[model samples]
Target: MIRQPFKARTPEELISLLSAVAMAILAAIIVMVLYYGREIIIPIALAVLLSFVLAPLVRLVQRLRIPRSLAVVSVVVIAFAFIFAMGSLLATQLAQLAGDLPRYQSTISEKIQSFRETTAGRGTLERASSMLKDLSKELDKPKEAANSLGTIAAPKAASPKPVPVEVLQPDPGALESLQTLISPLLHPLATTGIIVIFVIFILLQREDLRNRLIRLAGSDDLQRTTAALDDAASRLSRLFLIQLLLNGSFGIIIGMGLWLIGVPSAILWGILAAVLRFVPYIGAVIAAAFPLALAVAVDPTWTMLLWTIALFVVVEPVVGHVLEPMVYGHSTGLSPVAVVASATFWTALWGPIGLVLATPLTVCLVVLGRHVERLEFLDVMFGDRPALSPPEIFYQRMLAGDPTEASAKAEEFLKERSLGSYYDEVALRGLQLAQADAERGALAPDRLTKIRDAVQEFANNISEQDERPSPKVNPTTDVEATSAIEGVAEDAPYESLRVLRKEDLPSEWQGDHPVLCLAGRNPIDEAAAIMLAQLTDAHGLSSRVEAAGALSTANIFRLETAGVAIACLVYMDASSPAHMRYSVRRLRRKLPKATIILGCWMKDIDPAALESLREGAKADLAAATLGGALKLCIEATGVDSLGTGAEGQISKITAAS
Candidate 1:
């Protein structure tokens, strides 16, 4: 008989798998409820999210030796103050918006009519007219038939005395039934009260509560459970806080911008944006529509509507793309796929409230998976991706930078699970915009620092973050001896390229596998999925797209969420194409084993110039072997050899960009 090595599951392993599956099912149900009853879901979810937000402050007050009841009172007062401020602003905006509605609608109608007159416009208008005509015909038939009935009824009423009012009334029991219908609402209110009290007590006696919980888990596993719960609480709290700040900022920016534009209900729109940001994809679309409808109703001009669209275009991106990262770089560690899945699932079960709770709930599930055995798979699938772990990520990058492997590590995150919340639709848009810029080669290197800096800022409170030490170099080193004296030469940019040495390549990259690193305006997120299907396990072609995901722009979000890494760092050189530079720099720095390839708009390229650049980077500047040519190109992009260009020009592109 052959002896086989056996593997034993630990306590944490046992908990992870089972907990994941159970939580996933719960999340699914919650999503279904949210989808079916959005209006009801919103307030409930808002209250729950708010509970988390206020819980901390309540606890802080309690910690100061105040009574828990008093702390609850203090939290309530703060909530009222906040609500009043928001309500007042919202009221003013609504009033103004209402007054301006007719004008905006007329303006939009006029634009539509104008558009109809143009050649392309005419076809679109005709189709729309045909559709509208059909709808009107259908609608008018019912109205006309109903009106005929009304005429016939007039004779009957005249012919016979109307039934006595008392006779028409339903039985007394029916009235009681009507009252019963509202009983459900009353019960929810009672439940809400209980939840509030529960939350406050939990917050106030947090320390004692934790101690009790630790004891309950048993001495053998007490430390582990306590740590897991604490981690969950801390991370959950941090995420909610970051989300709140980001939402508020978006609202303020949108509101102020509308006001400055002289658009009606500017304040209301801003407040609306803020509130709607909490909703997923649907929220931004809705928020934009309200403004668009108002813009059209007020001006009834194509130009005015166009201006409104432009305003949203300019404002939404800055707020979502720029300010969003700056404010809420908190990584909940869920993959984009998992996030969407959870959001969808919870929305199905619990409605919008479920959506809001999805993320936190998922985090709790991940915690539970750490305890239970059956749900361990979920922890692996949905937990913060192993790719994000600096050590593992560093090791992979070191192993001859296999983007496929990097993608795999990132995919590992998908196993961790999620609770879907539409906390930042604007953030998603910003990410899309960044990807578009990356495709166009319009991105500037300076933007990445702004982006990364913003990421760092947004994710400031995250645990286990490495503290970077100020760099200290040896004075006696050959490269440092002369260059160190001049800070400019010695100042190493975090971005890469301008040089490609053997050491810069990793063990995985140094092999026989052919590699293609594609980047463009329409950056595909499914590369890993596609690559995974095509490659063998030995190939190591997996989810690891690069070393860093969100490099210089929120556009990198698709890649970030997909578990893509940035291969290299780039300097802001506007004269150089931003997209190409970013792509090349990334491949140069991040992927040591793989060669970087550029994805470009076919029309935009000057074939002759492209050939020159291609040849310059390769052997004979014209060699045909994929690996050799790629190596040549890497050599050409090496720093020091490529002279610098106008950085201010690059800065402008990023700023207005």
Candidate 2:
């Protein structure tokens, strides 16, 4: 038998695992209780949601010089009266629809006959009947006497005398039968009553309830609790108010459309559409199904059905895409997936009521999760807020070796910000991610290669596609240095090796004094170096990039003779600056006249460690970001390289008459 090694978990890891298990158990218990106690919980949830919707109305009524109780009573009565009146109208329409249903029997029969004719022919039905008759005859063959071929018939046993048995049953009276019939109705009616009373109380004492909840959950942080409660109330109230207006408008449009199309009981279908649409995702389709079916039943020519469908198709898209988004604007704070999942979850827990309440309930959960420290994971998992910022997204895509998407994201960002900002925020962070992975040895050699290749592609392609032309360094001015830089990679794009000519130099900048950007030992370092070069070029500063380790004695002499003024060494993941100190010191020794600035680019930095690194490297300055490094380089060189023309051109051509 072979014995395997057992790895023990750290204390923190163990505690985290146990905490996750406890949370899972607690969640399961909550779900179970919610499902079983829905009879009580559902009404409370409904009351809370309705109160959120109606609280504004109650407040408005209270502002008319009426007592609070009177305002509540008046608002509730008016609301219920409107609902009851609508219900009566619907009942009357339903009765009329029922009476008219028989008139459509001829139409339905005609449709059936048409379908039969289309499927085969009128003779097909008669043929089918004849076939069935023949089948019946064949199945009803008389049974012959048992053949003696393979069986010997046993003699019949003597018949026994029959025994009598008596069974007793109780008859249900009319009252018991009536009670059985109305039991289901009684539960629903009682729940409605409870919801009404709860809504009234909730509106009357909303402030007291809110204070109690804050004290219970956030006594230590009352400000945060109050803010969270206010946010939740405002969001839910706005959602309901906007939703009511949109749905009411939708119903009106539906009614008008149906009435124009001569659909019977158009108002009934309109009300149903408005009500059913409160449920998300599939509600519109379900609401459409009823009217569509009724249209078919009422009309033999299919015109009404077609028109009904067209009306829904047009209105739904217009409202959903245009008006709904314009009004809601991320108000619910539930993601699309979260909305669907919550709908399914709540529907399972409390049936249709749960489905109707899903979005509001989820909005509440998201708000709580956002404000409560312990429940923050819920917001992280379910909220509509972006899970990743643009930079993180770009970095992740690059790590996954998807340059196309990463480039697309970069391009989208470029529409709003400068190219240098994009490089600093997105490209630099991406390189840092690669550096971290490489340092941890989590990235395989081939994967690292792919990531490097992808990032390079993104950088090169995105630069070319920029609407503004990027500054280019003229190779004629310094052929040797340009060749030395360009020869580093035979297939490298121009984005990695552009040099500004004398004509493009800023007024205060000398053509000979360009910045020399050096890459460290890794590809990430080279990527950062390229980013710095791009940024420097954008500011009308001539710059050239080369790998520090790739530089030869001859190349160094050529660069020295090239009259470069600043040598910027970029290191993306130099934890201690041990590897880069030698490069900076060497560059300082070779280019004694030039300023040496070490670019220690990272997302986070320790000031002490950075100071020590700068001191050890014998460099003039150390910066944590590309922007800072560029600033240092500018200050050291004493040049403000902002350009006045397109593509790092500091002077614009004046049109002479």
Predicted model with the maximum TM-score: 2
Please give, for residues 153-269, the per-residue lDDT of candidate 2 as tens digits: 676578899999998878999999999999988987898789889989999999999898777675487887798888878777878878878988888899889999999999998
How far off is residue 280 in model 1, in Å? Answer: 5.9
lDDT of 1 by residue, 351-446 (tens): 655665666656556655655455566777777665334323422232332334433332333223110000011122233344455557665655
**TM-score, per-candidate, Cα-based:** 0.46, 0.78
Candidate 2: regions farther than 4 A off: 119-184, 430-451, 469-502, 506-515, 536-544, 548-565, 577-580, 593-595, 604-616, 620-624, 628-640, 645-657
Q: Model 1: residues >4 Å from true position, as ranges? A: 1-48, 62-65, 84-105, 119-195, 208-221, 279-286, 303-307, 319-330, 355-357, 363-378, 387-657
Most accurate candidate by lDDT: 2
Against the true structure, candidate 2 has what lDDT? 0.73
Clashing pairs in 2: 472-499, 473-499, 473-500
